[model samples]
Target: MKPTRFIDSVNCAIEGILHATRTQKHMRYHFLAALAVLFTTLLLRVSSMEFMLLALAVSFVLFAELMNTAVEIVVDMISPGYHPLAKLAKDVAAGAVLVAAFGTAIMGYLVLARYVLPWQKAGLEMIGTESETGMVVSVVLVLIVVVIMKARGGTGTPLEGGGVSGHSAVGFCIATSVALHTQDPLIAVFCFILAAMVSHSRLLLRIHRPREVVAGGLVGVAITVAVHLLFRAFG
Candidate 1:
């Protein structure tokens, strides 16, 4: 049977996906591992909004991968004889995917830290305990990014996970940390509200997408949970 143009396009896309899986098997494995960690440590414990954010980020990565595959195929077709420009184009496409994957992983880590290990470390009665240290770390990290962005005189890079905007990572961490420690429903509500506000601020300030903000939030909460589990196992 002859395939229609639409059918052919669909087949090409499916082939692209399969080719991506076959050629980038290690990359796919890494993504799947991250997803596993994300689901177990972050998604399970967060609010519905957090889960939505995770879904958005994951979708972004998948889209990036598809685009990357298309770019590679087009480049190969156009310059089958091998040209420097073709190599550059393909490299750039692959690089973009790497950046996206790296950003998502970082966001996942931040969320896990917050939800999994919100409290201070064991045997700490000092003024600057582990929890205090974590807060300080957060403050410093945020300020550093803000300062760097200011120094750059621009956003630096507006990729899906570039620039100093740690919307998904930091927001998730802070929100999850607050949610885990406080017993009151009001507290959870307030914490998430604050997180959402911060996320909105990122978009308003033109630093991130709604997706990025949500990713940060999920990563933060997930990280908290992961850390808690780790501590329990080792301690």
Candidate 2:
């Protein structure tokens, strides 16, 4: 085939796959799952540069999957007959996807666990739910869930009830904790702004719906309120 024709074919194949990906729920699930995992594992907060690295790695896996599918389709079209070399090529492509996914998972676990483990221990200590401990516990729990969902490929928004709504949950939880710890309205206001931005950004990115964002805001506010009350009770 001519160069133009070859390029056109490649574009058409890509278009078809993307089209199918959007319409096919399963494909979307796979894509979203990967994204969610990266998001939650990295805590999806406006915290650090490590999260950006995690995001890049996850994106690489998705990109590899798309490329692998394209290569396989093109190969099949070129040589319909079974061939050893063709099989080898396909297998190699698949192996690439696996390697990318595995690496992504490992990085996620490392980055997340560094923060998640301690948070888990603290959360388990919130039985009374009547001290700064309670708020800390709530935040830790949310963080843990976010890490798990991200590693496992969830679709929650970090505050609602799904993959990573824990972002909002934990955000609010921390904001409240900070407010209680400092007992300063200015600090509380700052935390609230940061939390709100995180929630809004999640929706703006189209990674979450409106319900998810609202829930995150509410969760943060609620956590703050609860912690304030708990502290007041003890004081």
Query: Pick by lDDT: which candidate is best?
Result: 2
> Which digits, one per residue and each the tens of the lDDT, describe model 2 over residues 26-96?
35765887767766754535356777777787777777777677677878998899999989888998788
In terms of TM-score, how similar is model 1 to the real structure?
A: 0.43
| Candidate 2: count of backbone clashes, pairs at least 3 residues apart or interchain | 9
Q: Give each model's whole-structure lDDT.
A: 0.62, 0.66
Deviating ranges (above 4 Å) for candidate 1: 1-12, 41-43, 119-235
Candidate 1 lDDT trough over 10 residues, lowest sum:
121-130
In model 2, where is the ten-residue run with the lowest total lDDT?
A: 121-130
lDDT of 1: 0.62
